[model samples]
Target: MAERILIVDDEPGILHALQRLLRHGLSAPDGSRYQVDECANGALALEQARRHVYALAISDYRMPEMNGVDFLTALRTLQPDCERIILSGYADLNALVRAVNEAGIARFIAKPWADFELLSAVRQVLQVRDLVIENRRLADLVRLQQGQISAQEAELRRLERLEPGITHVNWADDGSFILEDPGDVKL
Candidate 1:
């Protein structure tokens, strides 16, 4: 399975560069490949987001029409489970804070970011997402198993009530008892 990733920036150069940088190297939490899509502005990014459910979205701050924070907030409405990251070129304090507080971005990456740092952040966020998904799966399995155990226990209690004095009982497929020991039986 390929995990989808969206990268958006107003600068065509930055968008292209990041797309190139991110294309081949990263792995998703499930050990799957990454499928990346790039856009030049926030509106296009939003459109893409609506069309597809992305595993992660990385957007640049200070875009012409909409900033990264607003884009991510809207993206959240479209797909709340999609993880987010903001790329801030100038260390805009207010926008960074808003991105974290309002948009619920997982990380803020500065401009001129090292390749290792960017990939590392991406890995960590995706790993967290995968862990959350796995946890939910395990919880569901536990619930199902518990329900089955409860049913079996109830059946056991009913059987006990049916033959309270019998020490052992085994039935054949045709509904006939193959073995029955009343516990007080003598040889």
Candidate 2:
């Protein structure tokens, strides 16, 4: 399935340009395409985020009501797994730090960015996101299997407590179970 991406910028031109670039230049590592969505401002972007899932969000640094840092910070609360990127013409050290530390932005691309650089950042971010998600899924599976094994072990222990040596098997040299006296079998 194609992953969804959100783009938030106050400038209509920048939004259009970013949409075109992403639509034409990027695809997931698995060769699936992206479904790009755009919003003119952070408020609209947040609204869209509440309604749909996004794999990535690219936001302009300076907007009217909310800067990219603020918008992305709020977005993190809504979608902690969604990767974030900041684009700005203005290079404010403090704002950049805030974006990184607070919003957890994956990349900050300067305005007038090279097409290759932007595309590469998006690709790398998506790849990392995929890896992180896969790792979480694997960890969950491992945890679930461990729990099942624990339950099975507990059941065996309970049975052993109920009947001593019940959990043990007498194996013959030929790899078959060596049954003792049939009268000795409990159940």
Candidate 3:
């Protein structure tokens, strides 16, 4: 499946350009294309986020109602795993710091961005996101397997308690079960 990306910019032109750039330039690590969704304001973006899962969110720092930090911060609460990038023309250090600290943005790109740089940022962020997701999946699998093993062990112990030595078997050199007494078996 194509990974979904959310783009939030109040300016229509910037939103269109970003959508075009991402659609044309970026692909998931597996080579599947991205599904890009755009919103002209933070409220609209948040509304969209509630409806669908997003792999990443790219937001312009300056907006009408909610700034990039606020939007991304709110997004973090809704979708904690969604990666974020903030774009801005103004280099307000405090805002950037808040973006990094509060929003946990993955990257910050200055406005009038180079196509390659933007593409690279998206690529790298997606790569890292994929890795983190895969790691969580693997961790869950391991946990599930461990639980299965524990259950199996408990069953074995219970069987052993019910019938002592029931869980143990003697093997013959010829890969057959070694009977305690040969004459005890019937044809």
User: What C-alpha lDDT, on a 0 to 100 scale, does residue 178 get in candidate 1?
Assistant: 75
Residue 119, model 1: Cα distance from true site in angstroms: 0.6
Question: What tens-digit string does per-residue lDDT give for candidate 1 at 1-187?
Answer: 5768999998888988888877867866566778899998888887676556688899998888788899999888667668899998788788888999999999999998999999999989988977775675566557557784464555454443233323346779998987533232322
lDDT of 3 by residue, 1-187 (tens): 6779999998999999999999989887788888999999888888777667789999999998789999999988777778999999999999999999999999999999999999999889988988886775566557567784465666665454333345678899999997564234221
With candidate 3 superimposed using the best TM-score fit, by how many Å does residue 78's alpha carbon deviate from the native? 0.6
The alpha-carbon deviation from the true structure for residue 154 of candidate 2, after best TM-score superposition, in angstroms, is: 21
- Expressed as tens digits, the lDDT of each residue in 1-187 for candidate 2 is 5778999999989999999999989987778779999999988888777667789999999999888999999888777789999999999999999999999999999998999999999999988998887776566557567785465666665454333356779998999998685344331
- Superior candidate under TM-score, 1 versus 3: 3
Candidate 1 RMSD to the correct structure = 19.3
Q: Rank the candidates by TM-score, best first.
A: 2, 3, 1
Better of 1 and 2 by TM-score: 2
Clashes of each: 0, 0, 0
Q: Model 3 Cα displacement at 186 (Å)?
A: 76
Each candidate's lDDT (Cα)?
0.79, 0.85, 0.85
Per-candidate RMSD, Å:
19.3, 18.5, 19.2
Query: How well does candidate 1 score on lDDT at residue 77?
Result: 68
